[model samples]
Target chain A: MPREDVEDLELELLLEALYRHYGYDFREYARASIKRRMWRRMMEEGLATLSGLQERVLHDPACMERLLLDLSINVTSMFRDPTFYRAVRDKIVPLLRTYPFIRIWNPGCSTGEETYSLAILLREEGLESRARIYATDINAAVLQQAKEGIFPLDRMQEFTHNYLRYGGRCSFSDYYKVYGDRARFDPSLLEHAVFAQHNLVSDASFNEFNLIVCRNVMIYFDRALQDKVHDLFYRSLVRSGVLALGHKESIRFTSHADAYEELDRQEKLYRRVL
Target chain B: MVVGGSWGGLDALGQLVALLEEGCSLALAVALHRAADSPEGAMVSYLQSRCPLPVAEAEDKDAIQPGRVYLAPADYHLLVEPGRFALSIDAPVHHSRPSIDVLFETAADAYEEASGAVILTGANDDGCRGIRHMKRRGGVTMVQDPCTAVRREMPDAAIATGAVDKVLPLDQIAAVLNGLGRA
Candidate 1:
């Protein structure tokens, strides 16, 4: 067999070990991205091959945690795409207002940027008191960070720009207090927020939600995994519940495609119609 | 796959498209650096007019079809997985989210020796490492000659890597691509 084939076999075994031992199912992730992340983890650990890293991770829980962090993409920003937030305020807020209470689920909420952004949006619209936002991620480490709500102070400039572009009604700085290198966000924003670890690959939907914002998370999943999550989302959403994905993500190709109607095609906002 | 960057990329791509024959068999993926929020469907409409092949922005898990050209959508890295395309919103590489390097490197791994990468007019060095990866993986690597490029930094950087298989003008790149399709 070729060297590349041998490496592939090793990678498969590694993923299998990870799933069987750690209950993290990365087997269905897009292979190219997984392969790149695996190689990167190997380099970081100073190991020569995927099998070596796998052995370390399986035996040591710390190693597994480190590897999990590496595999889980934590790239995010506050109101990363301003237009999507604008659509939420312009199009979805009115519908959310009609309800007595709002339950919003933000799966794979890396470091709580989107969660806080939503909290701010709801507060600005005077709906925060009636909203309960559940911010979940597979990685506990990131969930901890999300609960803290502290970000690099330097990133505030970019976040402020995004906030303004998203039609923020107040000064962006009003939400957070900067100290040296870190900026601590206002705790009032998270009063109704619940931060928890929820693995999309393994966990079932716990409750029906009025809105589910899982932007950019599905892009990492393969077709089968994507279908599975879409099913979960379909079951979890209340009638006419809103689902907002990343700018590039869509429901057109999923099994639940027909169940939701496109609310904003450009912003990837969909509403449960059936 | 042909990856171009800033400067005269649009014009060069138009020229290359005009020169290629209809119904080319090779599946083409183009990564051109654009604003993350640029209007979708704009590139498809612009390029479809000049090219005979079907042109569209790549969507997640879309199967790679021959005789078609797929453009990397803005703000997402287009990765070539086995038999399908995957998009990533991971941090931008070399300040580009739809980085030419990400697409080319993934293509090199997915297609191996069967792949051909073309680096065209650009002001950045994003495609240099990707072309090198392609060449190391036994895939064909070509660069637009720096003299003919509107901005020489990109082609010059690829050439500096010493992994480029051909250095041709924009007009001739289509011919080489057609020959690769035949092969």
Candidate 2:
């Protein structure tokens, strides 16, 4: 047919190869964004077509790892949306305080920026000892960086601004020390946190949680995939537990729309009502 | 329908939407260059106050509906699927988030021949390539006549490509769009 249609066919074959060979199912991700990422990686690898990239991905483990990084969409920042964290402090923290212990899941926690931010919030609220954060991602490469808790020092200024805007209680610099081009976060911030590689697509619920902060992750998933993950979240959360999503995300189109009550609509926080 | 503007966009957008009238029978996805941290939902509220069509800032997975208006939320690239809206934080194209190119390209791919693109007063050329792609895909392409635009550069850039199907004055855009929507 058309050349565009041919490219789409190539894209489908490559994604299928990626899923079957790698067990990393990106088949359900949003088409436009995922396709763009595929093209990006293809060009980066000096390959001209999706099929050509697929061959290298299957043959070279190193190629797969690099492609994984792009597909994971690791773009994030400390308190990326400050208002969401503000709501977590004002509205969600009190609910966490009701419980003697707290389990927070940070799914798709790429590079641990927000995970550390969450830990800092917990410590500030004096909930550090009582709370345990399960920071997980589909890519282990990012999880290792998350565990290290170091970020580009250049980004510190923006994160510091976000921290202040969120009404941070202490000097933002108190949390980290500069090391070369990086700023290494205090180890205590990660003491109660565990990092792991968890696949949201095929993995089952491992534990019930008091709060699940999965921001900016599902925007890359399609409708069916979003519904599947929402079901997992619904099952993974305790009754009245909080679910925070990316600022512009909503539960309205998902299967669990009626199951959760809006805790903060603008911030996309929902409380499991039933 | 995909609509794009940059500099001097607000007045042109306001007048265009006001003239589109109620029950226009087409979904309008608009992208204008605005800073990411501008007052949240302020533009949507402003547009809603003047436009006959229902206006709101886009949210993920929002289904595109006829006669409704959707604005690209700040700092995010707005994309389209067959019948819904998708948002992305992917690095900005043409130095703009909610880049006119992103919206127009995806909308053209999804809607194909049924899509229409209108480029209006912009200082930059973000929407030019998109309108060209839209024309190649059998979509209708229109631009505000450069002479009538506040910043003639954007429209002039689009017209230079010879891809625009029609180049109308800013005031006359609504009538052509309404007619196209009906057809």
- Which interface RMSD values do the candidates have, in the order shown? 1.5, 1.4
Scoring each candidate complex against the real one, what DockQ results? 0.68, 0.55
User: What's model 1's overall lDDT?
Assistant: 0.88
* Model 1 regions lying over 4 Å from their true place: none
**Candidate 2 chain A: worst-modelled 10 consecutive residues by lDDT:** A71-80
Q: Write the per-residue lDDT of candidate 2 for residues A114-146, one digit (tens) a residue.
A: 899999999999999999999999998999988
Candidate No. with top TM-score: 1
- Candidate 1 per-residue lDDT, tens place, A202-245, comes to 99999999999999889899999999999999999999999999
Residue range B83-167, candidate 1, lDDT tens digits: 9999887778888888898899899888889888988888989988799889987898989889998899988999999999999
Candidate 2, B1-183: lDDT as tens digits: 999999988778887898886768989999999876677878888787788889988898888999998999888888988899888887778889889988998899889899999999999999987998899889999999888889988999999989999999866889987786676
TM-score of chain B of each: 0.97, 0.97
Q: How many backbone clashes does candidate 1 have?
A: 0
| Residue pairs of candidate 1 with colliding backbone atoms | none
